[model samples]
Target: MGTRLVPSGRTATRLLQAAIGVVLVEGLLLQNPGVVVNALLSLGVTFLPPVLARDWEVRLDTRLTLYIAVAVFLHSVGMLGFYESVWWYDHLTHTLSATVVAGVGYATAKAFDEHSDAVHFPGSFLALYVLLFTLALGVFWEVLEFGARLLATAVGMDPILFQYGIDDTLLDLVFNTAGAVLVALFGSGALRPLVESLTTRFDRSFGER
Candidate 1:
């Protein structure tokens, strides 16, 4: 895999990509330009670190990143169309959507990596890891939404409040945790080996061997 670094050119390229994403969201996707821009900006910030630190295996990570980008973009499109007015509740729903997407993305990446023999972590351990990671990410996303509200308020933009009550946030955490745990538990057993065998076969057929 190539080294992950925030090369100046790459950063510029990412920004350009983000700009193009904004255009697509606004045009083809029929989302508000402002909403699309906001979502893309957030996405760019989230992805920048991985691109710079290059901590993840590229083959799997690239797919994970794309999944996240598309999910977030679609979530933003939905919010813009449905909400029309940004409320705290709207923000909370958006956060929920983002968290769910991210959790699924991580699980998918782990599954693919295991199939490809690109990485290995014990199934039991991976289950715990996924649970913990999902919970941590839930908290992290809340913090991000809070920060976004603050930034918007500071700039005299409409303040998006946390519409979901504290109880709702807790519920979201529970659901997010459940989703990851379920995937890890079911996926790590018979599914992992089967997937690996299939992937091997497919790769062999295509002269990847």
Candidate 2:
């Protein structure tokens, strides 16, 4: 399983990078600097962790890297204006991103965890941990969105906040939670093994904080 994953993981990573490059060019041609900003920011968010992981001596497999890229790819499309034109695009992206967030949290928890550790707990506690982790990240994202708006206002650009109103914000949170719970309840079983393998291959893991 591990051997099969490594090759496909690299393919996914390259495909994602190429697709994002296309999005970048598309953003540039449209002269929509905001889209360009969003795309670059998305790419940074997608890839920066792996870059830092290398320096920090933490393991990040190409499959996980591709997952991040897929999450950001959804955002790149949203930045291109599908979030407005398509009634459901916003929902889809939020759900996808939130699920990815949960995946990362699960991987991180698994990487750092030792059954022998005093901080470790069994059963529902781990599920709860992932849920809370996802929710906290969702809120943090909202905060960043608002912060970006504040910065935009200070720079004299139109505030992008509240574009979809309070309903948008609330719905985003709802979807985020839903995604997290779905992953916790179902997806984790399949994903955990792959993540465990990746972390083991690297031979580096985070300690409980």
Candidate 3:
């Protein structure tokens, strides 16, 4: 058997970007407003890493950039029937998305802890804090999903978001917790660069003020 070649980070990113564009065109052809909107939004989000690096000087390495892109791409594709057709698609997306949320929470809080003398977090406490932060965002997302479904039903329009049920909601939260735990345990090392960058940015902004 021939060896398979793995794509480079930049190559994979470009392929995903092109795939998202295809999804956007598919949405337009199908006349599905929900898919169209989600695709458009996700396409915009994929550009945020470079934008932040350029405008804010908050640089994210390729891994984190690809992390965000993967989550956004999965969710955008889920809008096109994967959530209904593929059994674990929702779970996978939720877990991945939760990682992004947990990463942000950890990075921001850790940056603040490092940047401020008054704010201090022990390692254990920071881990717990990240879990709570992710869970809180997960709850908010579920609420938004439920609200969207309710509003759509009231208006007799298709819902942009879906609320599966209590069981699914609970499972989503469970997966979210799993993702948070992974980040808490292993993300600190991988996330150090981001934390340092954020800390520097915070320091500069405060110094200016």
| Highest TM-score against the true fold, candidate | 3
Clashing pairs in 2: none
Off by over 4 Å in 2: 1-8, 45-63, 158-163, 193-209
TM-score, structure 2 vs. true:
0.78
Those runs of model 1 whose alpha carbons end farther than 4 Å from true positions after fitting are 1-34, 41-57, 61-70, 81-121, 159-163, 187-209
lDDT of 2 by residue, 1-209 (tens): 32233777767766777777778889889876667777787777766655555555444445556667788888887877788799888888888888888887776676556422545656487688888999899888888787877787799874443245578889999999988988888866657654665455445444323
Clashes of each: 2, 0, 0
- Report the C-alpha lDDT of model 3 over 44-157, residue by residue, as the tens digit: 988887787777888776778787888999999999999999999999999999999999999999999999988899999999999999999999999999999899899987
Please report the TM-score between candidate 1 and the true structure: 0.48
Question: Sort by lDDT, best first: what order?
Answer: 3, 2, 1
lDDT of 3: 0.88
Quantify all predictions' global Cα lDDT against the true fold: 0.51, 0.71, 0.88
Which ten residues in a row are the worst by lDDT in model 3? 1-10
Per-model TM-score, in order, reads: 0.48, 0.78, 0.92
lDDT preference between candidates 1 and 3, better one: 3
